[model samples]
Target: MGKGAILGSAALALVSAARSARTVATWRTVRPLPEAPLDKGKVSVVIPVRDEESTIDGCLASLRTQRHSDLEIVVVDDASTDRTVEIVRQHVAEDPRVRLVRTDGPPPGWAGKVHAMYRGVAETSGEWLLFVDSDTESAPDLVGKLVAAAARDDADLITTPGRATVPNSGWWLLLAPTNVLLFDTASPDGSRGKAVGIGHCILVSRAAYDRTGGWRALSGEHADDVAFATAVRDAGGRTRLVDGMDSITSSGLDSFGAVWRSQRKSMVAGGAMVGGPAAGAAALGLGGLLHIAYGVAPVLMSLRGNGFVRLAGLAAWAAQAAAHRTYMVASHQSGATAVLAPVANATFGAQMLDAAWRSVRGGNLWKGRDIR
Candidate 1:
């Protein structure tokens, strides 16, 4: 009834409606790389590994099951102290399609992963190159489906917002949905400026990669995924972001701390890409604040006896929550995680701010390597 209530209700309705529409659109527009047979092409899967001993074995096990007959798997081991090399060597002995390359270190000014990727690409001769992470587990027909999708869409690069497999820990539940939200919000389209290539499972044609200058172009980036997509777009190549949930999944973080720490470099890079740290931080902070307002404003208005505003706020909150739930379900993640949307939002906002601060202060570190 009051002017304050009227204004608050309008804001809530608009934010809720906008988010709901995006959620529905994301689900409706982005379909998984469909299961289809592809005409045989030499497809190379390049995995850049560090100290991924815990996950490398399962990753390799899944790769060995890929149904594509002409597939070549190149695992480039960056100077790791763990048993990652040993685990990969065991796979090499068993599967002739798998080869292991050891990297002395990254070249001058190159990120470790970038160096490993370049080396891996050099060792393979496939027409289509898939740069996958060591933590990823793929379905037997993943390569077949992705190759077919790239061909069908006439896209040069295919990046996935990977289906993150959360651990049994409740901490994972609180933190994981933030990743989904970030992907859904920041780069809804796999456009040039806002591209979000999930580094864990990126599929790009050798031609497109080469056209974009390949790893060399993105050598300085901490978040190779976004950088890789951006480079492809800048080079006049088409890039598409698809649902790879059916074909691939990835897991690694065992706790909330691990998730937070691991995300810094990529988050910092993301902020840098979207203008600069201050602007990126503001955008992220506003998004999270808006979500919080949607959930909290109604309750506050109701306490102030603004029944109409209260009703609007509650409806908006419910709609926003439903939208998140729908997205999670479509993305093959747990719909239950949607209940923690507020927490996820706050966590995301905080992470973005921290990343921005770290970027301003000077670079950050990933896997003991400095990311500048």
Candidate 2:
């Protein structure tokens, strides 16, 4: 048994345990907002659509069946060259509560989604506004529950994380924990206490939104959710991040390319939090440690060591695997995906390097627009 292998195994095990504890401590599960009726305030759901024809109907259907009665759905079409407009129009015709608006295009310096949300907000009037992605399908009580939770906590903004649905591929599972970690760090409990709003389903009071400068304030940022949360927190507004797995699910990934593109975009945008390229490089080094220590080191030790070293390596690997499994289950992913932890860690390491490269190069393309 080599001294180095034993030391490495101990360190890796400790890291895995610490990460698992942090995830558990930071995880915020969503409960039903309240048991009250919908007489509190008028709620407006602002959905930004862009070539989401396939998923638009289901999303609209979810909104239509909301338990909350005083709700208006505003769908902002970002010049979709598809049936997105047609689908939204159909909903508008059938249900008076749904309205469709179009955006000419995002002006220079404005990200597409942020621009669409800004336009949607302009066309709708509601005491409470919910910005939901077009691909997300909400449960009937989602809006009511979120509104009630915000009111109970006296929170100005509430962001809910959705369950990821990747029916075709398991590789996409790797990206799930990235969000869990991000959500943990982005919430008030992280080092910065900066509450980052998850874009899939974010609910905010109109007054609190205006206090943080609203969509206009996040116009130039590539990652509007995090930027918006930072703004809200800066303005002394209470920001809450909750679990939306029961209330909403996002099935946007149909291919590995989709997974890659989404992960790349997030990594690039997330670099803004730590100081751009330099921070990304530093993070890459740190991310590499997980794969090397937990995945590669085990294999090397088992092959090279005599007895105790091999056992230590195996134990560390098991610890990491268990920690990863717990995280997957907590994040509403299939627990079976934990068996693929090594692959996930390797992919993450590669993605971190790729993200650093993209950050150094300025920005990447998202939804056919450059995010810089």
Candidate 3:
């Protein structure tokens, strides 16, 4: 065969493989579990809070209204100098299920969140342990669904990707798309079984938590959620991911600055965990540049009128965008955001490039810490 034929065959094979993998990862319908038997296993919910006064109330209120009855809510105040503690106190006063604990400071060699979670876990007792972020609001049935998923699947660790609600601002429109795009692409259905889950919401059986040594086992890791998931999988424990749309919504990002700093910090810290600043910078930089190229190349091809090339590019972009929209719609994201997904994807590619450069320069910052 000619070189062109060989190249064409290779391209076809690559596309076929990607499509097959994506299909395998797409969500499939599962038989819903029967209403969790009333008075089912007890659950202890642990949230780590630090200067999150503005968003803590909604998060706490949502927990107060959980459909599940046997729940104990524990909020660990991670040395917040703001009204975070006061807010928790108010919730604790109003709700008997709520408890507040305070930690002095994060110990050396531990991430702030891991440290806070450890503190909260030490003070709670239940058959199940849930670690949720302070900025996340759970649906009344969120806990029930998670518990049901665990019980039905006999899973040791269960996690759901939280829905991101970006503010209606140009800045957010441009930058906050990173999470939407990344999570949507990286977190297809079966992918969760192969990868570590995000920390935004994680639920584990108390028995599994104890067997794995819980938060303490991953205290030194920056990407605690992913590390914990890996640990669980490594130990022959079952891990499952559920569609969390009916279960939770993240407090929309407050500003573009928050988005930028958060992404940069994540890249740096994640990089450090793997191979330090240099390796992290290279990975982010190359990955971002390639993604940007992928987004831009189709537009250029369409303009050039190379019919076959244009068709291929358009099809690829549409496939990716539609897949994202389907996931968002399933997650109950606003129809408007789903429609604007292509724009969101392009913006995210740009922001990732910016984060890559910062990570390389050793200038990533998070929670007042220089991770790089």
Say which candidate scores most in TM-score: 2
lDDT of 3 by residue, 1-372 (tens): 356634543453345236433533454542233355334788999999888998899999999998787999999988898999998999999999999999886888778888999999998998889999888898788888888788777788878766666643333345334433344444422235344476778888877777778888888777677677767766667777666754677764445666565655666677666587777777777767755655555455446635466565555545545545555455555434544444555666666677667676653266655665
Give the poorly placed runs of model 2, Cα more than 4 Å off: 1-7, 28-39, 165-172, 188-192, 254-256, 272-294, 302-312, 357-364
Ranking by lDDT: 1, 2, 3
Write model 2 residue lDDT over 49-91, tens digit each, in one string. Answer: 8889899999999889998879999999888988899888899
The CA lDDT of each predicted structure is 0.73, 0.73, 0.68
After superposition on all C-alphas, the RMSD of every candidate to the true structure, in Å, is 3.4, 3.2, 4.0
Ranking by TM-score: 2, 1, 3
- Residue-by-residue lDDT tens digits, candidate 1, 1-372: 678768768777677667666666655766578768575689999999999999999999999998888989999999999999999999999999999999887888777888999999999999999988887889888888888888878888887755667643323333444544545545535641356577878888889889988888777666677778877877787787788777788776545666677676666555555676666556655654654554555455545645677677666656666676776677565678665554554556566566666666654356775454
Better of 2 and 3 by lDDT: 2
Q: Model 1's lDDT to the true fold?
A: 0.73
